[model samples]
Target: MSSPKILSVDDSRMIHTLINKGFAPYDVQMFFASNGAEGLEAAAKEKPDVILLDVTMPVMDGVECLGKLKADPALKDIPVIMLTAEAGKENVLKIAKMGVRDYIVKPFTEANVIDRVSRLVTLKPKSAAAAPAPAAAAPAAKKARIATDAIKILVVDEHPAIAESIAKAVSKRGWKVVPCAGPAEAQPHIASTVSSEETPDVILVSLAFPGKGALKFYQSVRMNPTLKGIPMVGLSVKTAIFDQNEAKETGYIAIFTKPLELGELPDRIARAMDLDITPIFYSSEGDCQVVSIPQDLSETGSIDLTRQSRKKVADFVNAGFSKLIIDLTGVTKFEIPLIRAVASIIHECNGLDIKWRIVGDDADNLPNLPTVISTNLKVAALKELPNPFTNTAPLDIYPTRAAAAAAF
Candidate 1:
């Protein structure tokens, strides 16, 4: 079978990351464009099997692009999916009138992208592809795993591997994870907990639970007077809009779309359960304060990281540390949210007169972030980001933590 060609026309680099990661297991020929005008040019040339077109973009917006696509008989035949936000009802209605095959909302995961595209094209897993896939597991780092086991989490899913992955990730924060095979086994355990007056702190249930058992479980739990308000977080595929809505209406505390950001899961659980999430990203190295950035940072996660780092930076400065090392070595996705956070932290460091350097690489796009940031000088996301930190520029990014520390 020929590799399916997929074109993404979105300005956000993070969307590219999503597509790349989600489709990593498949043999796909993917193309990307920064805007709609560029998209038209690429679509004309590449002639992909499908196009994932964003609604709002620079140069030409999705609406205009769609109009042009339809106007041109050759391009009009290719299936197009609209990328939009939930709030853009008028535009969605307009695009629907234009006969789009489907639409995906903002803040979506690769699961959403794959689900939609699969409807138009047959997606084959890479395992069944013609060539053998080479895979490697990174060596696990020794982290300060779980200070205490005060919080008990119940993870109910059809797949034990998934439940185990969630367990291993969240267990780092010292939360006790109870994995249940399905609603059948989970109910008995949940019931037993109530008798002991020790019900779980939070429940993570799959929205795609076999036999729609997740909804049944949620409703049963909600209707139970004893466990009426226990926090319940729903895990769902990106395109499960109906399941998500039903989960919301049925009173789910939060809904996290899969593939789950395991790095951010602990923080989300902390917020939902009202647990004190001491920053796991901070450390002391000799006379320097080392800050490690999380790899999977969401918009809200970025805000929280900045807020947490601000307090830590002050504490470290008062402790007589003269240098700050903002580590971005593991970060590959440099979305707008993280950019805002990094800029804010750097700006804060400047105000306190602390010398700081970033630890990252060209591959992760860290070295070029400050350059792009300097362009929009008036944006409040980083008022001081454009200004010179030294005589050179707003940032001094190094290739490694040792190099950054040595330079400072």
Candidate 2:
């Protein structure tokens, strides 16, 4: 198979040289552009598997260029990863909403760039060639190792041994696996899956494998909605300055190093889901550090507050996260058991070292009856007994649900 082509658009020749040097060991064809317009031109002609886009340029900045590339029918499917100087929350959210695969802040390490790109491309797979038709098989079906609708996990690395190890670790969790040698082969898979309704759930990628090729692929995946929500985790043996920053800037939920631990996956998967199920504990300095639960309680939707959740919440209160933030925003309708369970959590919090605060959007029923009924059991930190904390309270009515959540 031919090496995958990577289009790297940046004003800095140093970055281009660094990227090429980092990717030299991989099977990659490199393309460079000094500005977004030229980058677009190259992308249109080359139809490169992935494009590494720098956000700031002299003519037609990265954002504009990205819009043009995505809008064009012939080039839309190609993935583009944006390279920006500042990976601020606002900027990230803006580009994210605009559909960039991923963003790496400036001064990123070579490994960071490669790691992010590899995962995104592998998850989506794109190419010019048509897929081969499925062949006929025997009537007796084989019980598949992975379910057809299983959460797909993409593993990227040049080393077969490492890839196999990752596959073993992830398989323990009952996830489907797709392994690729580098970004070139990965892009076609990304494209095909992306064109369909079902996409991979998570991507585990190595930054050093395809280097810049990974960057381009990440860009493309971020732009597509089907692939956007999928979780990404980066793997590397050694962490560098840029590598750590890139992990944060590129929007990966977490980064892990090689000699992969099978046990750590449950926590990683939980974070990827953004469950807020992890408990926040106050450090000696009063800062917060997260403590993980054995399983994602949110995934199960309703957890019996019998022992485990009760203990976890109690621990948080003991550790000084007694200032509780319960998000009842999704819950308009509540059952009696759920209400009681919540009340139990609060009761446990109050007895511990911390003060519990019930912070959430306002309920539809003012002086909500369920809440009132459960008040004796409430143990959250707050000022008033009946009224939940509000910024500009004593309102004639209640603030909007969003407003209440923010205040609490």
Which candidate achieves the best TM-score against the true structure? 1
Residue lDDT tens for model 1, 1-408: 679899999875556556766787887899998788999999999999999999888988888898888888889988999898864778678789997889988767778889999999989877655556558765676343222446778889888877888888877667778888888888875773467336776899998876677889988787666677678999999999999998888788889888888877877776666443435667778788877776666565666666666666666554546588888877787666667667777776776567888887655366666665565445775564444334334455788778888896
Checking candidate 1 for backbone clashes, the offending pairs are: 146-174
Let me know the TM-score candidate 2 reaches against the reference structure. 0.33
lDDT of 2 at 220: 63
lDDT of model 2, residue 376? 37
Clashes of each: 1, 26
Question: Which lDDT tens digits does candidate 2 get at residues 205-323?
Answer: 67665455445657766776667766777777765546645755777666677766655554354455443332221112133222211222332223333234555655543333434
TM-score of each: 0.46, 0.33
Candidate 2 Cα errors over 4 Å, as ranges: 1-149, 192-197, 275-408
Every candidate's lDDT: 0.76, 0.59
